[model samples]
Target chain A: MEFNFPPGLILVLGAIALPFLKGKIQQALIVLLPVMTLVLVWWIPNDYTLVLSFLDYQLSPVNSTPTGRLFASIFCIMTFAGGIYAMGQAKILELTAAYVYAGSAIGVTFCGDLISLFIFWEIMALGSTMVLWAAGSQSAYRASFRYLMIHLLGGVVLMAGIILHVHTTGSTDFTAMQPDNLASILILVGFLVNAGAPPLSAWIADAYPEASPSGMVFLSAFTTKTAVYALLVGFPGATILIYIGLYMVFYGIIYALLENDMRRILAYSIVNQVGFMVCAIGIGTELALNGAAAHAFAHIIYKALLLMSAGSVLMMTGKRKCTDLGGLFQSMPQTAINGIIGALAISSFPFTSGFVTKSLETAAAASQGMVAVWFLLIAASAGVFLHAGIKFPWFVFFQKDSGQRPPDPPGNMRFSMWGFSFLCIAIGLFPGPLYRLLPYPVEYQPYTASHLVTQFQLLLFAGFAFFVMLPLMKRTLTISLDFDWFYRRFLHIFAKEFTVKTSNTHIRIEHAIHQRIERFIKRLYRHHGPHGILARTWPSGGMVLWVAIMLAGILLTSALL
Target chain B: MISDQDKHWFYRSSSLPKLWMIQVFILVIALVPEFVLHHHPHFQENGVLVDATFGFTAWYGFLSCAAMVIAAKILGIFLKRKDSYYDE
Candidate 1:
């Protein structure tokens, strides 16, 4: 269908206007914007494309491929659910920034060229960082600065890659990119950083938990998923991503297991979840790509649901650590049930959303005879259950009571949780509709005896392992060592020590020079005062001798030259 | 006595019955396709059975769980300190 107005753009503008509306009107606008975006997303025709010609390149601002539509649809749904969750909170700025963030993520999906994607990418960085800043704590401010530094660095890499790619290919059209050139590799590095790939993956855990409870819900949805969208569009078949993704999956679980902060654990799991999608994209078959896209779609829903549940507990208890939280399920049943659904879904338990979407990746690996990759992927799946799927719910909801009985979150929060929980189960039960929305045709089925039995054995055994090792899983107050220590502690200490040492050296040098000057002055004073020949001088004789000596020195220098 | 009971079921207790119930529930769900939905497309083909029986899901699941559990256990050996480990 040919459209006159940009529906996505209109929804974004409406979201920007929401916080200004005041009271219930703001809430209405919050819900209305995402629903409106979803409608706009559906209304756009599958084949319809919009392109604008720049100086030497063409930029498509509106593209409606099934892949783009699927991501945009889920992003819109996230904004809607996030809006409902954050409705009664006092931080309007965070609410606005979140919409802008979500909108730009949708913008990234619809973008058909490199420049357009870059523009939306930076906008998401700025908007999400603002949400972090809106958390209204000193630590949040510091963490947001670090967060901004990483994203800006990523943006610089992305921009440089795009410029090089355009210079090389004479085209900026966002299409399936093969890593044959330096430019594409650079672009992939940029995308991998945002996708929470290793080495740089520490940024997510370090910064996200510092955000406001509602702010984190928004933080969880946009940035990494947009990177996944970029990867799907740009470098689908890059072989190296398979190993990189595998590293991230295990890295997330291990560090999360070591973490005490509830939100940090979830933040780590985002990397873990996105790793699966990245691995799927790396596989690059039609089924694998579909699995990646569908998982991203399903992931945003369930992950947000999971974050919202954690956020609710943080909101009620004023605690964000596992050691400080427990037995909340008794009072917050709605939150508890919804959280359990999210946990189950993330674990890939049957009748949950994860079961349908995640299985496709494993199936893809097997189909390709990538035995090692498939093995690692399955192990990561079980690890996912161990760390996030079961650990999160068990520790946060059902562990030893901390004797703090906070009431359930507000009605709006409950409603939002219920809404996302329903979506998680509904999609799991009916995978057909989701499958149809994928970019490719769907033929793979999720339910079968062997599939069930094996998935069961794996997950159940993983649970058994969890309980068996419960003694080792006890929460502690210590922060796990991550790559951030290089910046947060080591470099910081090195800088401090260097400053002190250099300043002390400067003081020593100044003192020595001062003493030398003082000694010289004292000698000069003593000589000139009463004790020296000059002090007792016959003035004419002294002047004559001094003049003769100066002449002699000048004459000697001239002779030497 | 009440405190002991609380510790038994809720905290320190093994509660094998609850664990078994969870297992049974998982097994029933896992076997649903074979017994009840026998006509399902996934089962109509032998790929699913071969893939499952040949250690696709079982191996993947067990190995992943084992890796995580082992890692946690190993880390706990060194990393798990008293609740006040960092306080000093």
Candidate 2:
């Protein structure tokens, strides 16, 4: 049977009914929608394009390719897992927004035209903003506004780029392009903004942490990963992304190290992880693209898993700061174990999902013999273990006891965490299935003896460094500044100053004009008033004399001619 | 009401040393493979080795992490502000 409509629409349409439904029905739909979407994602045959005639153009609203399928598959799985996790505690609004968010992300992957891609891109933005808004805190509300401003700005830029690109190239296909013109550069900037790249990288850490525990799990999965997918497809082999990606990687590490909020730390690491994918996309080889895609898939599962663990703690304990949490393993044993598994996976420990998937990118880099890039990637790998891999679990679940023993999150959340944890190990142990889904043929192995040994040495020693540097790594009640500060503080102050100064200058100018006009009017009154020289009653004789002179002059001129 | 006395075995002061010892043992075990296994260098060119020095990954990992921690600390002096920095 052929399914023509975009599969993501299933979730998008289904989610609309959620707020109206109650109890078992809503719950059932929550689980059922993603499953149906997944089935439909597969049911759509390869290379199938559902085209619609719009004006002078053909739009492929639904296009199926291996890369799109890979991303769509993960989006479906994430929605499913996130649904289960959020089922118990998330408000109806959050659940609804998240589903829409997930669906649109899927829609973006399957887009065959720039216009269709853009439409889905916008919906994803609105959906994610709504999800953040549903957290229902003052911070969440405020942060949602900031998040919206940035995304809308990005969307405008993207739209402008698309218009220019289509006008220049006279084609609307969402295929790869060289960054040789204004339009393509704008598009790349637009994609980078969503990928948590620099100058705006602070958005991930600033906004994602403000979400409700479950809200964050959903937030962690979609926006940036979708951006990665877009970049992988749209701007492959763009070398500039490598430097940008590396900046994000270290930026994530440094900031996460200083972060006090557990969720914020994870939020920063999302930037870090996306940095890896962005870097690999910059590499732009088939293997690098494959690695970027595979890493994104693995990243979503483990990142969600990590956030789930953090979220569980947030929900049960009513605290999010690392300084406020410790020794939670006793009460939340399953959560801690799952959290550790996620940490290990993120660190790319042997026999975990990250190790297998991440190696593909590095292998690509190594093959190219880009020595500096390779070394930096290796260093960043170690940095990942330090900040997210060890620091997250160590401080949150171990460290000094804060005397809070919150029990494991309720059944559904636990179920979701275990499910993802299982996938992390399962994929790590058997990468063949995942590798086959890559856009390119799989020609790499991850478990060679040298590879295994080096990975252990790198991670273990990084772990050792963490212990040695424990004194400096103490959590504090502070936040490190990022580019958001420009808008959050600097632009705010600038706007205030601008308004204040402009209004003051306006008043001064008005007063000066008023005074000048009053003076001019006074001078006019003095000269032209009834008692003044020009207003005197002798005007009749003067008028008669002037008239006679004018008549005489005219007669003389006529006679001379 | 759980008390400090009810601490998990993993966190117990007695077990802390044991955990440390285990960590040290694993670190040793990880290095043992460096001697036993033939190393393949990924960043070599022609005949010159760029990255596969003896215990390179191990030391590099340790030093890089330490550098990051210190760098964060130094940067904290300039960038760190109270959690309520934005609220006001």
Candidate 3:
């Protein structure tokens, strides 16, 4: 316990060697790296953890708490699943970055001190941005830049908060606390911004869609879920998060409804799904936090599955717009079916992974006697089916025939899809394994008759509403405005035109003032300018008289004023 | 009425009525849980009255979706723009 190596560092540092290995060697390394990390992560118990010293401060580098193990286990599983899916398809550069990104997420899960957390957090930002930039398209590059800016700002704010928090409390332990003080509030803002909370929730939808096909699968897994992990550890039971999480839940659905790109619809659903987890965290009970944790695990599987299915379509057809994709179920049945499982799981259809996990949050809400929250969560559950469960599949696979008969993607892609598809059903059918891994002990059962009946009625009727009101729910070739409107359009345009005009006016007025000042200066130059009498060399007697005269004149002016 | 020749079996217009029938059956079956099961309220609140009804979830699901769709359509008036809106 005196000294121990972090499991994440193995995968992250292993990424440096990724470009060197090729074909079988690279594939072996890719799969083996996570396996090795998983072994290392669990090999040490919670008691056998290490603390290091640097510059009079103690830093806990490897924290193997129950919650940390749960997150790391899921992250390692996701990385492996996503890796298998992206095998031989994604660019070597993107794979390398993804490995680093995922490893950093695992690192964050195990990090015990704010110092180690901040470092791992930054590495995640760098690694994820690299994954996006590896998309190699112009728009992907631009999106990654915007994504980096937001994360960096979040990192800086978090760093400052950590510094202030440590200075005030004389400890760097990362734990739950209300954001009552400035440092904690700043820290909360930092965490919320990353959680895709408010104003910046748009970043998930904005950046995730721009990645390369398989690249999006990896992109969807790590970053925000890691933020959910951070929030669960740092701000459990914080009241403001309830409002933030609720806002994100609805915001994601409404935006997804207006979206035309199929992948973007899935991306928006990521925000929506993550919103459920965030709300649960805000509920802040042991059951609620466990719900958040379990939901994050389930969301990773299903969201990645959805993105993988969409990515398969995009790769096969070379078109991402929903208007251009339909009747895919005929040709790419597996892909379509896989996408449907993901959709059902995401919408929390009974016996799906989401059903097992998200219901925990709803139950938590109910237990707390928060009637409105329970109602809204139920509505959001239905809305989940309405927008993602129905809209995504209907537009892509079952709508008016676009007549595009693209085949399913490569073998690895198919295998990956099947694997995640299996996990979704397996988890849904028996949530015991996931529940046992949760931070808290479990007595909650997902298969109660009341819960099952209520969930079915809610989902099916939402399906009915979707078809009955099909015209209103028609997909348009359009995008909707979000809070990023300020940075993306409004503030950008204002900074462009408004600042230019103001600067121009100031320059013009300064020039006019200079012209007027020159006249007075010219008049004075006759007496005191460089070429005037004051500029000319003077005798000692004249100098003394002039000094006396100037002093007398200055005294007279002061007296008069 | 899509006449595209390469269309799948599911896409054939002849299957429309069956699909509709299936959907209607699904809606009908949704009420079974309400009729047979004792719907437990999370908060045990007796006064709100929504949970007490047999088919309240089905109705609530439909109405909430309807409200959301209507809200989205209204908001679309101001927020929806061409897909290339952010391109510039």
Candidate 4:
């Protein structure tokens, strides 16, 4: 089976035409493009491949594995839902960029060669940066620059790795490779950078929230998850990912706990959720990889849903800080309910998408006898409930009334939420369809008595702990430092100081040269002054006597010669 | 100051205690499943099944959550700055 045209190109090409067409046609395409892409996503058979020649190498521009299909399916769905949500409010540039962003993410999923994957990868980075920039705020502009820099760095690293790999092995296939060689290691570093892994994990939280509310809904779905898909496909079973994933999980939880901004909290949790996927990919069993893939699918829905609710709040209330939000449930009942559903889904509460999908990873760990890993993952699950599940809804909706009565968002926004809320529960209640979509055969059940009992106990008690320790979790008008501080703050200060110091030294050097020239001029002035012998006019008699003596001496010398 | 007249029932002083009680009751009910349901520990230690202990998930969840919160607090002291810290 083969496709003459790539499925992702529908949205990419459609996005190009979006800005030109206005009103109904634009709106129709906004929704139509993704749905078309989704149909083509599934229309292609599992064995589909479209290999093309690129210079000396054969490039598989379009390939369909079960994992790629699953990811592409969700990418299309997210784009469709995000398109609907953003249509009423987002600027034309934002909508166009977001569609391209979503399209390229789908592009990455179907790519079977490293070169094509890198092409789609860079397009995603560019498109998302444009989406962020379209927010049109000063901070958004600065954040977009920072975001672009990090992604470009990651792209460079990935390209170098691909070149090296192709040069050495003469293969551009983007398949699982051990991180034993420098090329593979560089590739892993590249993927990890985008996964919001450590030392640079701060980029996700730093830039994501800067986008417009609708823009963020699109922003949340693609970038990191594409990296997760990349890791799952290209570096599965690499043990280093396990350690990196653990770091990201905890880093997200800890930072989110201290974060004051609502969207930033969600931003941090993106890193956290991707952390779980990365860890599962590291585990590398069929079930674990399935867990990673399934979790990515489930995560995109819930995370986008979560960000939508936050976006709606940000839109209606004109506020993004938890310190200024509360008791919004009184007026915005629908938004509140949707948010809680999203919260429940993200927390992996029973009968939600997260419950069925995240459990696969835990089960894999247990099955593999990784007791410590299983324990840590369980603890992190509880932590997820604490920070994202309970804290987000609690602070934003149910805490002390801020006396602000912003109604629910506009109709389209609510409709988008309803659609995703339906998916969160639908996938949970009936995971069989989703399970069958996995690359591996389904051998797991999520609704056993033991699993239900344990999950409920864990989540319920986490909820209890949330209230019991409410003081510690109180919202403050403060932001916690993350690794981004090195760039946004520390490096900023360093660069400024370096510039000032260099300019000062530059001035000092110029002044010294000027003084030396002035001194030489002064010395020359003194020697050549009217009072000096050399500067004074000689008397005519004195000059004539001197001339006569010199002439006499020259005549005597000439005669002697 | 919030007038009692405008307060929603959820936040009204009189309804707060009842809400707390309901939460605690549901939490207790969550624990009851441990007694009725047979346990399947994800892992075990040397013939001793640690997860099989009564209310282990409950305690672990609560403790781990509390620990994370406290840990965040400790770290926040050193790391926390005014929201305008970056803007400056």
Which candidate leads the pack in DockQ?
4
lDDT of 1 by residue, A117-136 (tens): 89989988999999999999
TM-score of chain B of each: 0.45, 0.82, 0.79, 0.86
Query: Model 1's A-chain: what TM-score?
Result: 0.89
For B3-51, candidate 3 gives per-residue lDDT tens digits of 6454566766778889999999988887866656776555555356568
Each candidate's fnat:
0.42, 0.91, 0.86, 0.90
Q: Candidates' DockQ values?
A: 0.33, 0.73, 0.66, 0.81
Superior by lDDT: candidate 1 or candidate 2: 2
For model 1 chain A, the run of ten residues with the poorest summed lDDT:
A1-10
When only chain A is evaluated, what TM-score does every model earn?
0.89, 0.91, 0.89, 0.93
lDDT of 4 by residue, A1-561 (tens): 448777888988899999899789889899899999999998988878888998999899789899999999999999989999998799999999998898899999999899999999999999999999999999999999999999999999999999999999999898999999999999998998899998899899899999999999999899999999999999899998888888888998999999989999999999999999999999999999999999999999999999999999999999999999998998899998999999999999999999999999989888888887888899999999998998899899989888899989999999999999999999999999999999999799999988898899999998899999998788889988878888887898999999999999999999999999999988888889776667988899999999999999999999999
Quantify how close model 3 is to the true structure by its C-alpha RMSD in Å.
8.7
Between candidates 1 and 4, the TM-score winner: 4
Please give, for residues A1-561, the per-residue lDDT of candidate 2 as tens digits: 555699999999999999999999999999999999999999999999888888987799899999999999999999999999999799999999999999999999999999999999999999999999999999999999999999999999999999999998889899998888999999988888899998899999999999999999999999999999999999998999889988989999999999999999999999999999999999999999999999999999999999999999999999999999998988899999999999999999999999999999888888887778888999999999999999999999999888898899899999999999999999999999999999999899898888988999999999999998899887889999999999999999999999999999999999999999999988888889887677878868899999999999999999999
Candidate 2 lDDT over B1-88, as tens digits, reads 5553676777667787898899999899888876767777775554647467788899999999999999999999999999999998
Give per-candidate clash totals: 1, 0, 0, 0
Which candidate's lDDT is highest?
Answer: 2
Model 3 stretches astray by more than 4 angstroms: A1-3, A502-561, B1-6
Per-residue CA lDDT of model 3 for A34-103, tens digit only, reads 9989998888787456789989788888888888888898889888888888887788899899999999
Worst 10 residues of 4 chain A by lDDT: A1-10
Winner of 3 and 4 under DockQ: 4
